[model samples]
Target: MELVVNSPLQNQIVGGEEIVSNTSRNFIEANTKQVTLEHLRKDCIIPVFAKDNESTISHYQFVQKTREIAQDLFPEFQVAEPDIRISHLIKGRIPSAIGKPAKELLEHEKTLYYERCAFVMEIPEVVENVNGNNLALTIGGVRAYNQENLFSKKSPEKFKVFIGFKNMVCTNLCISTDGLANQIKVTDVDQLSFAVEGLLQQYDREHHLGLMERMSRYLITEEQFAHFVGKLRMYQFMDKSEQKKLFPVSLNDGQINTVVKNYYSCPNFKRSDDGSINLWKLYNLFTEANKSSYIDNNFERSVNAYELTNNLVNSLQSGARNWFLHN
Candidate 1:
């Protein structure tokens, strides 16, 4: 995917970088002044709230809030309708005999309990790129089911927000990070704007222009890319002396080898004319491989892939920045 270098907000610094250095205590103290929902909505944040006289909100309400928030945030950008997924935990004994009547088994089960809900929205053509490719990011808010299933708890239901970038060319989210930090939880409904602002601030601090500048200027040799791959493998698979187990455990060595072989054989593995690969290309390979290696249908597997890719990209970018600054 190509990098987006000309975003309107590229030059503007919405929040100062120094805020990140302050302790959480100090940061909260400084931002503790009551912020109204109107002000937050102006910042493109739609705070979720229970319906009148109700303590909890329905799944439909959560998804509608996400759609509202995305529309407010990127009016020009194409916002896909939010997809809501609910996971249910079935607690029941397995049928004693094979091919037992499915309906009868369900009758014996006590209940299907709610596990969690994820409200996901796709923002297309957002102005951020990796390796010259246009990238889109997904914003999702998740709420877990509890006893009240509503706002019965004293503290507000903290929706865990995920902000991830998608490769426009490949339509893959393997390289997307959670803005700055992973798993940002929104505890105060009123302070949603501040929470998002803080996340963006942290991202700017960590992924400031210096990193991009270095990527634009430097390229790594094939050997260097190989070394990086080794580092990445160690970072992800190493577990105290052995590689971690691969999914769908039935796969033999030859099957695993074929998957790895095919991945490296892809066109993304090629180097540029300078006899060195651009950091973006190298990073993209990892993300592509991450997407291919995991079981795509499983949400947990997808999340793991995203996290792994995010960490690898962050680490590689940091290393590149250091290499350029010193060398």
Candidate 2:
């Protein structure tokens, strides 16, 4: 019997929902706050509830409950439903007998793990021996800005009451645009857990570290001195580590001069140590190159230097005994 081999395209084909991929593409450019609450409630989260066997409810279980309650309370807001045993729904697979350890389905899954603290309700509420210490109603806070004081004072926003679990306010309703993120006001806690959990999970999953990884590569393989300078300035100025992880590419001499001139024209650049040029700081004058632009000849010298350094490094990684063996 003869066997036929398939082409690379056919052999490597993988199946997945095209709609989900297209949907996630839009999600990539969106920030946490910009994402719609309805998407969080419907697509991302699940609902969870308290059970008779208190021992069965884990901390992660609590977070799931919070999400569901938040969704149920504000159904119109498009919150996620509460999910009990949401961890089980995460979709992971055990390693094959001859292969590696457990493998998660999604490489970039981010989840909120929560623990139960307490439950608060009116006289009709049921009391169960849960792990948490305190429970209270989720009341909206009035945080009005006082111009003279420059600080907002918090007063309870009446007409909204929900349960507090592990210092987290949860509700069985949806949040309108006006509702506070922390304070969930709903009639049913069970429904809120699903919505809240879903939104948070969706946000975490949509935002990956691709930009940071690309930037990191640029830092290690700097081709132009000008690019490094621009990158260094951006790196130093950024407050978040994730944003800084994006490495700047190599820049040419002309690009370096343009950046310098731009800085000189700015008021903030004059007073800052970054703007002033000294011989010691001259080495790092240039920063990243714009990949989309036409290639410049500045990288010729950098290429030669890089080749020499790479040869030495490659030799070291390959277990060359003597330092001068390939010199």
Which candidate achieves the best lDDT against the true structure?
A: 1
Give the alpha carbon lDDT tens digit for every residue of 59-129 in model 2.
Answer: 33333355345545545554322221111112222233223332332322322211111212121122221
TM-score (all chains, Cα) for each model: 0.48, 0.19
Q: Write the per-residue lDDT of candidate 1 for residues 26-92, one digit (tens) a residue.
A: 1012111212122222322111234434334434444555566667766788887554433332232
C-alpha positional error of residue 124 in candidate 2 after TM-score superposition, expressed in Å: 33
lDDT of 2 at 66: 51
TM-score of 1: 0.48
Report clashes for each candidate as comma-separated counts. Answer: 7, 65
- C-alpha local distance difference test of each model: 0.42, 0.27
Worst 10 residues of 1 by lDDT: 25-34
